[model samples]
Target: MISHSRRHCVVELQALPARIGQIRRIVSAQLRHWQLDPLIDRAALGVTELLSNVHRHAQPDKTCTVEIEFRLGRLTVSVIDSDPRLPVLREAAMDALETCGRGLALVEALSEAWGARHQTGGPGKVVWFSLTAAPAPVAAPRPVRISSKPVREPARTALVAVDPGAVSAGMSVAASVGARPG
Candidate 1:
């Protein structure tokens, strides 16, 4: 089996008011690249709410980081901050709407999965989420069809069978091809 990993960013959040647009742009770019724009809009909204809660409820000035891991079949976004308290999940009826208490609840409903974890060797928590299996790639642009002629298929692509109960995708791909890039 094989694993893919990527490190994203570390940013200061002393100016959260100015960071909304920046956050939105980064998330949009990543989602569009991953072909997950359908949920990008929703994720963006939820992420914004999450960040908003961090900014408002946490200390007055702090450094926060947004880390995203994007791979062939999964994406995870984590916001690390210097706060020890894990986020709370409460019924909306208990809290007034103006205090931004609904952010976590909204995220719960929108995300595939999310949670807060205490950072190792540190004094804070990392609020993170997991997004799975981006959408299929978009077909390249082409000229308009002028006739009903048959289309030519692309070259060098292979059809690999997939088993319903395969334990690992990487193993399956390697078994099918016999070998792969190191």
Candidate 2:
């Protein structure tokens, strides 16, 4: 069976500085729950970059959403912004030391996988990334042994009969366990 853990937070703030604390709290908890802190740092950085980009680009009163989903072995964190403009991959020189061009580039380097796509239900698009964490090992189920001696074949594979009355009833073979009172 697949078990998924998930969380979502909405941010509708104007200033970038105001939302950092909230983002940190939510993202840190998710990272810990997923057991991916080492990789989570990169994810956090990516989230920060994405959130900052939203704040810089999206209009005021625009709402942004952050979501984290944890599967058995992988974790994904997505930031959905109101802006329909998807993030563009830019080719910048590594040593250029550019002030503004390094945000998304840095995100790309840190995350295992990161990209943007249009949101399915709404007009705006979602910019998101996925990170895989070490999966918890599943213990194998123990096998059961059945006796080799053949007994009376059961009428049904697995069945339990109950008469809806005040009666003592039992099934027996060579020994009389209890007689059903009808």
Candidate 3:
């Protein structure tokens, strides 16, 4: 289940292996609804990692709250658990077979900024990451150029030329059409 405001969403659930997948889908759908399709993959991945951490390392119980917010051109995803202990970002593992300790590292690479801290109004800690969502700068429209000078064309008269400036300036310039010599 989820509760949401105009720019924020919250989900409270047990961070079990099964529930994690559901939370990911919820995040993706929310982003799509907000017209942030580009951010769906990154947000979903970051949320998954945070929830997995809650399931694996958080103590006491696996219950947690996930919050997703879009504010001031940034999309932030956070997971709050009862565990007071903050997570430490470990160095990247050297072996390809290693899979247990790379969650935080992956989050760091995917997000513009990320951190974990003790909750301001509670005992637990919230692990959060932010991705930049600023819209691309729009190119200004090119100014339309209206030429002040008029275009001149050769008159159909056998030996006459028309001055475009005189005609455009309300001056009359007449030329008699002559028969062509075949």
Best-fitting candidate, scored by TM-score: 3
TM-score list, all predictions? 0.64, 0.62, 0.73
Q: Could you give the candidate ranking by TM-score, starting with the highest?
A: 3, 1, 2
The residue pairs that clash in candidate 2, if any, are none
Best by lDDT: 3
- Candidate 3 lDDT at 136 equals 60
Q: Residue 180's C-alpha lDDT in candidate 2?
A: 49
| Candidate 3: 10-residue stretch with minimal lDDT | 173-182
Q: What is the overall TM-score of model 3 with all chains considered together?
A: 0.73
The residue-by-residue lDDT of candidate 1 on 72-153, one tens digit each, is 5666777777888888877862355456577787777777898988988898888887767555778999889777868887
Clashes in model 3: which pairs? none
lDDT of 2 by residue, 96-124 (tens): 86677577788778767888898888767
Over all chains combined, what TM-score does candidate 1 have?
A: 0.64
Segments of candidate 3 deviating more than 4 angstroms? 136-182
